[model samples]
Target chain A: MRINPKTLEEVAFKLLEKAATSLPDDVKKALKSAYEREDSPTAKTELKNILDNIESAEKLKKPLCQDTGMISFYVRSREIENFVEVRKALIDATVKATETIPLRPNAVHPITRKNTGNNVGEHIPHIEWIYTDQDHVELIASIKGGGSENMSALAMITPGLGVKGVKKFIVDTVVKAGAQPCPPTIVGVGLGGTVEISFKLAKLALLRPLGSRNKDKDISRLEDELFNLINQTGVGPMGLGGKTTCLDVKIEYAHCHTATLPVAVYFQCWADRRASAKISLDGSFEFIV
Target chain B: MVEYRLKTPLKEDEVRKLNVGDILYITGTIFSARDQAHRRILEYAEKGLELPFNLDGAVIFHVGPIMQRKDDRWVVVSAGPTTSTRMNSTTPKLLERFRVRVIIGKGGMSFEVAEALKRFGAVYCHFTGGAGVLAAKNIKEVEGVEWIDLGMPEAVWKLKVEDFGPVTVTIDSKGRSLYETVKKSVEENLKKIYQQI
Candidate 1:
């Protein structure tokens, strides 16, 4: 089974557009719950309006939010060559779409003071490739909204604090960040790995199924404790106070330096707007509905 | 509840009578600016340009929104509010330099901004963040774009608006902020809820 470049570009571009306009079921579920649970007549009304906007945007094939974050893709490839060509074609496509599709441009170098106008920058589609035994590719795209991205936190504590420390950090950060990151978020907690690695792991954790487990028993149990403790924050739907503060807490961990215990907590708004696709060696791809 | 629609060049006495939670469907003229413009305003204060508009009874909205195609011009798409905290460091300077009477945005302001609001007889209003579309309905026209070079979502957009509904007073004229109240309550609730479990 061999994948071709043409199919990859075709599949990738379409997935990007669909992800922008359509709200996944998990996201809709979380949003609906938030709308129903919101208590402030003002905030509640606002949430309801947001929901209506989401539905209409999807129906009209328009962007859900004007901020349409910088597009980032994570691809798992196998025996793939011409990777450079693949990147060029995608960048061209992204730029073209910036005008044709008219996606808002959000990518700018921190200091250079340059705007890509197209979301693609120097290392634009920023791809992280994973190696697997088979001849297939699993690619996922997630939009990193600035508000929530700014709320991500990492703390290196003594190994002694363990789950207790993790719980406290998660709750404290969310409470302090109330409504800032857009609450009732899907939390991605990365444990173990080095500082940067752990932060990356947490961001990657967001790609997993909303309520799915890590498959490792210890990690799974820790996720449950953190999830329960987080929702208990009662930061509520929009921080107006409600039973559901977090839709789910996904944990991704890696072994770390013996003396170092690093952890990262990343939050994705209820939009949780992301989509994944599987490309078989035969050059066929299917989006995870 | 008090409501008034006045132009720029506001008077302090008119500003003093306004209270928190009072619904103001502000008409007349208001200037829009976000990160870049705020930074420039600070620079303007140091060099001292006559300033763009009268600030006494005027409202300043912190926004950088989507540009949509109108019949012949660009329009605001969900041109709703952005986070106000990011501008906290500049609000006091903005108020004192310009004598701004109203600061409209989402999220709350810092203590310094609150003090400035009280001292200046101004108030902070929290318009919905994602309600750009609904907020645009209040805006009758774009007026024109100020800094086109800043690019979308960063450029300073001047808009003439009508009755934009649903913008509530989160931070008030008397120096009390609803965001702070709710945030403080959230902290207490978290301590109580997590302390036991």
Candidate 2:
């Protein structure tokens, strides 16, 4: 059985619309907790404003952010028969959604600086595919804003520096990026992979639900330690000064050569817009969130 | 810590009176420009070419809003502030050449810009970065736009705003920078964390 391209396009458009206006359950919960835990009046007010903005955007069916962001797709599939059509459907749907959902024309040439005007340009809507034993395709769509993307960092430490160095680097990145990426921000820390893969791992780490803990107890402990270390910087909500600088810390690691330990830190603002769905062969779909 | 209600065509003294942490609710006309737009403006300055709009006593907003066409007219959908640091290199020149009284953006500017703001009697205000929907609600009109060749995100958006901000002064004409202060305090916190670890 195979899903028709038109149905895929329809599903993709619906996913983009939801990604723009709705907040995921886990992220909403995290924001509510941050608001409750906040102490400083200024920070508390900022959090309240952010929550209000979320609610208003939902009600009005408008994007929560101006920089609608570069769209990304992570697909895990095994039994999808028209794989080629699936790719084209995703691209076509993205262009269609640009006008319907009214997403910003975010793709532009780096050198000539030409706007594609359709949110479809060279390597935009970056689609990454992963194969799994599953019989259906699971798709996760995320809109990564510019301000938060600007705060991403990559650090290479000597082998002797160890995990301690990674912690220091992550904390330093958050401090240097104070108020720039919009706190209380979600932090994704990638450990051990080489230069390029480390950055990719950090970004992929952001796909994990906010409150979900890592399977590795040791890594989960590290995530908690870094979370506490980052909040200790006193960056607070919108960097105004508060106790809740970071909402959550997620870590992912891959084995690498013994010579160097490369770490990457990725930040996502409170907007944290992402949604997922499972696509079936009968031209039907159900949202994962 | 004062609260100000400023209108565009801002006066020098009005901007000079702002201090770090002062809140402002601004009204009137303002132009939006980001990284590429700033470069084009500076290029115009170097060539001694006349700018498309008057800059003297004007306020500049750092944004790349998402807009949609409705009833054959364009309307801003989400118009939140962008990071100011990206414009730091070109800002002092813009301030010096245009005599802009106020700059509204997120993220603070550099020490160089702080000095320039002091020299030019200007101030930098920070609007909440992710509050794009709220920001759009405050816009009264989209008067006009230019530099379409620079693309939508880099285009110069001329907006008519009314009581359009819950912005805070992050950099004032007195050379005070809230970001710098935050950095210092963060360093102190980092020191304590290092001891704990």
Candidate 3:
């Protein structure tokens, strides 16, 4: 049973709309817990406002943030019979979503700085493909705002410093970022790998649900330690000062060359908008929250 | 911290009375401008060109809103604050030339901008980051727009708002800044974390 292109387009459009208009359940839970744990009145007020905004967006069925963000799709499938058709359908979905959902046209020419006006441009609506043996196709959509994305960092450290070096780098990045990235952020750290891969992994790590731990024991422990250290910074919500600086720290790693340790950190502001769906070969689909 | 309701065309005395950490709910007119709009405004000033809108005693917002044209009128779908730090270099000049009373944005501006706010009798207020829907609900009308050639996000959107905030005064005319306070504390905490590592 081959999936129809129209069905793919419909699913993709729905995923984009869902990702933009609502907060995922895991993220909402983390924010509620943060609000409860917060001490400072200012931080509490900020958290309250955030919660209210989420409620308002859901109720109004509006885009959660003005910066609907540059959309990216992560696709996993068993086999691709026609890659071009699939890619075209995804682009068509993006255009339709932009008009109906009225997403802010975020894509532009990097050098010339010309607006594409439809949120589609060169290599945009970027698709990252992963192949699997599964019979159905899984699509994950995420919208990352410019403020938090601007705070992303990468460092090449001397291997002698080990995990100590990695911890220091992570803390330093968050501290320097301060309230700029919008505190109580979900910090995604990609350790090891090459230069580009490190940053990619960092962004990919952000796709994980808050409070989920890494499969590796050491990495999971580091995630907890970093989470605590970041919160201790007292940057709080919107950097006004409080104990809930970061809601969670997620780490993803890959083995690297012997002499170099590469670390990258990506931030996802509390909005943390993302959605996923699984499309069966018969054209039926189900959202995975 | 004290809470106050402010309206646009703000007076110097009212802005001067505000201090770091004060809360504000602003009404009246506010103009939206992001990075490109800032640069364009200055460029127009340099060329001795008349600006389409006035900035004197104005409330300037750092935002790139999502808007739609519904039949005959424009509707704000989402209008939230953008990071102000990106406008740090251009702000001091804008404050000097325009005497903008309030700067509404998320995150915070640089120390120099805080100082400029002091010298210019202005204040920097922080809106809740990513709270776009709440902001749109508060925005009552699109009064007009300017420099739309710069693209939708970069265009200057003149708006009329009602109780448009729960914005906190992060930097006041007195030169004190809540961001600076937070930064100092973060540094001290970072020292301890570094030692542990």
Q: Could you tell me which 10 consecutive residues in candidate 1 chain A have the lowest summed lDDT?
A: A234-243
Per-model CA lDDT versus the true structure: 0.72, 0.87, 0.90
User: How far off is residue A159 in model 1, in Å?
Assistant: 0.8
- Winner of 1 and 2 under TM-score: 2
| TM-score on alpha carbons, each prediction | 0.90, 0.97, 0.98
Candidate 1's C-alpha lDDT?
0.72
Q: What is every candidate's alpha-carbon RMSD to the true fold? A: 2.9, 1.4, 1.1
Global CA lDDT computed for model 3: 0.90
Where in model 2 is the C-alpha error above 4 Å? Answer: none
DockQ of 2: 0.77
**Candidate 1 lDDT score at position A33:** 73
Ranking by TM-score: 3, 2, 1
Q: Pick the TM-score winner.
A: 3
Looking at model 1 chain B, report the run of 10 residues with the lowest lDDT sum: B128-137
In the range A1-289, model 3's lDDT, one tens digit per residue, is: 2457898899999999999999999988888888998877888899998899999899888998999998999888876877788889899999999999989998879887889999899998998888898999998988889999999898999999989989988988988888888888999999999998898898889998888999999999999999988888888999889988888999999999998899999999998999999999888999997
What DockQ does every candidate get? 0.43, 0.77, 0.88
Question: Highest DockQ: which candidate?
Answer: 3
Docking class of 2: medium
Looking at model 1, residue B157 earns an lDDT score of 72
Better of 2 and 3 by lDDT: 3
Ranked by DockQ from best down, the candidates are 3, 2, 1
Q: Write the per-residue lDDT of candidate 3 for residues B55-91, one digit (tens) a residue.
A: 9889999999998998887789999999999999999
